[model samples]
Target: MAWSYRKRIKLIPGVHLNLSKSGISTSIGVRGASITVGKSGTFLNTSLPVLGLHNRQRLSGPEPPSDPTSSPSDRILPLNQSRGNIFSSDVQEITSQNMQGVKEVLLLAHQQRKELNSDLLKTKASLGGSKVKLVISYLLIYGLIKRSIPEQIKSDIESQKEAIAQLQQAVEDSYVAFEIDFDQELKERYQKLVDSFIQLTGCAKIWDVTGAHHQDRKTTRSSASRLVEKREVRFSLKSLPEVKLGFDALCFQNANGADLYIYPSFVIMYSSKTNFAVIGLDELSLSQSYVRFVERDAIPRDTKIIDKTWAKVNKNGSPDKRFKGNHQIPVVRYGELILNTTTGLNEQYQLSNYEFTEAFGNAFRDYQAAIRGTKQR
Candidate 1:
């Protein structure tokens, strides 16, 4: 059996959303000339049917020129279309199938990253000899060798320009412009949510539920068994930096994978795997709870130690004296926050402070309601 998919949706004037088996991309321009950016890369397309002239070139070598009038659409490139890293797959929708591929890529890359990095460096070294002289001359002329402005600073400035140009081109090619105003109440609520999020400490993401078991017993039976669940959680290696959320936009670095950027209308989910998706704020939901976690490693300062448990516990919850290495462990209470949407956006985060997490969730919910009310009016 053979299957194929192709679609070209006109999002706005001179902007088209192209869907293909390869992945989703955006084309900006008119019939005679246009530029398309996608997972594959940027391509310039030009055609003159009357003159029978046509040309297509991939803009991979050099940074393309920018349009002064265009704005930046940082979240325009949907999932699997990012060129940052290996998560370059065509994510049509936020489905399990689409995300599974990304997870596989992440796992595979993690396993072979060392080998891949070594091989890549060796190959680059072998091929970089000819470019070394040019690099040195460029550095010298740029005052990097003189230790003046600093090469890093210069590179950063250039990079910022390139990034803006790319983002602006994407916006010009795909999005339409609109504006919304936030009332004083809405602003206050939004600020409260932001403050709560900033106060959160030491978060981890529950990536997968590895195993689950359920057992039921009749009332006649003295012994009863309950459901048991096991989850696979991923923690960030380093602490997140302090980032302020404004009325316009805010970005929260997820403990494990994606960075969640909240906007007035929607949220942008971006993963290190180079995948991104935009979701409406109305479609998103938040739930909060508390968990008594066994601490085998260093306990976070913000987490509350509500109880104690044995490393080797018996059926009755007592220490198993038979185990020579049995030790008492603190049972820390962690605040759990789960964000869900009908469109397969499910994420679980556990933080040290439950109060802050709960406050954020409540504030967000209230703010969402306020936005809905305003739109209706």
Candidate 2:
């Protein structure tokens, strides 16, 4: 009766026994049994297995039945809201990182595109500049070729020294031949020659030979009367006075009725004893007043006025002195007077006194001599 080493325990819905001996202790509970013995009397309890354990005493009266349609797995745990939220956050982070990477790539691509575009523009600009330079060079070369080649050829052609010299000499000889003494007889001869040349060349329509005007009637009358009286008086005198003709002794008349009574082309202050006539081609009468009488060692070509004057006096005695006034004499070949006139019909029509004179030499004896040569030919 001193406590036998036996104990009874109830575990969940089952009963079991636990025993201890020799100063042993034991305990029983509804869930499990515990035992202790001697100095090592530590009681140990064992939990009942939760599976297939049912106790009527612990059951609450009439527990509600589970729905047959509900799945046991569905009821195993409630929705893990925090887990879902954590997953969503992780997904969002991953997506954001991908988007960021995409944005960076796009930015880099855009920058690359801009750089490429800039490089393209620069390359295009360089090409355009080169093209422009090439074009300019081509134009310059073309211009040089167009302008220089012909001029060089012409220079080469004209560089024949012997030919140029001969031409110059010929021009000089022709000019000298045209130079003539200024005299009234020469004037009349020149007029006749002009008329004859016009007729010979069938250039009557082109050549103008009519004198523009005459000396004043009173002056002409006085001059004539004085000359007659002087001749008569000289016949009576023991010795004739030396009459020195002044520069103003000559007169000029144009086909346009313009009359110029002025000094002879040069002064002829000659005494009656001197049979030799001192002729002068007035250099002052040139179109350019300062023109040198000689051009390239040759007397410059006579102008038209000079030719007219020569035509007027070809058959007359040489004047003591010759002077050119405003008119120029043209260069006329001995036999080419009429031909020149015919050929230069347009020039004649458009003739100014200056141009005419410039074309011909002094208009006195030179002009007349040219005409006479033509007549002889």
Candidate 3:
């Protein structure tokens, strides 16, 4: 009988494999192996040596030393597409199947990871060059995680902008005006305005926007009644310097105290230097705030409105005088006694919810759409 010798077989144009006993072992390497040279060209896996895949050797001499200085891990190996550190005919067959989409790459990478962990638990893997393949698998997974992230985020943001524009227009179409007598109809209108303001601004309470730390109404009355009189309702975005201001006073925690020209159906707000008004309107009413317009714009930033002649004065200049039997409260107040929404407003700059909403909505809608449009791309 003749002794048989295994010969290297050419599988394809560039891929060749040795059928010898040790060839398969060296080709795959063990798990947790160090990273090796990148694959040739753009092929998924690195090349191996049956075909002398990499012509350039790391050694400088014609022959390798009897005792090599390099560790097994230091010797680079080909990256296998499968796990188990053994690339058999089965693995090759599985990879040949039609595969597409993002998860395909991730699934194979994750499978290989599980195989490596299984080997670790069983202590069957020395992992030397195998780690290099694991690294490639993880790299594929990492790439998939970030896929379409930036674009999807941009799409979500763009959708929100359109929602805002439509919401503003809807509010404008719903605005209703009122005169002196504050009735249930007026109250409903006021409530709707408050609702839309809360929904769009994300301020669940006045403090969320105003940063007011008052716990109860008594504390609120003491702190907030005089708040607008002081500079608490000033253009400063928030009561606390640490917090950012909202788009308008309605969004502020102390919406009643904010230095804005408020009304039952709408409020007009603007920067100190600009004549343009940013109007907040009732989504339930379709008109102007006719009862009266507040004129804080005419009042100085730190001025106070004296409605009652308090007999007592504190060091802080607050009058503690209560209304007596003969001496009644002042004709006007912006507090609980009345539903007046015109305090501190700029009457001269007042506009019906009708006039302002359409214009403001039109102008702002385009600007927002354009801004988000740039982000979408």
lDDT of 3 by residue, 124-167 (tens): 12222234433554577752566454344344334433333332
User: Candidate 1 on 136-215: residue-level lDDT in tens?
Assistant: 65667854455434444444334334433443444333322223344566657767866665555334433222222223
For model 2, the superposed segments whose C-alpha errors exceed 4 Å read: 1-95, 142-377
Q: Is candidate 1 or candidate 2 better by TM-score?
A: 1
Query: Please, what's the RMSD in Å of model 3?
Result: 33.8
Number of residue pairs clashing in candidate 1, backbone atoms closer than 3 angstroms, sequence gap of 3 or more or interchain: 0
Instruction: Report backbone clashes per prediction.
Output: 0, 56, 21
What would the TM-score be for candidate 2 when compared with the true structure? 0.14
Ranking by TM-score: 1, 3, 2
lDDT of 1 at 58: 20
What lDDT does candidate 3 reach at residue 360? 30
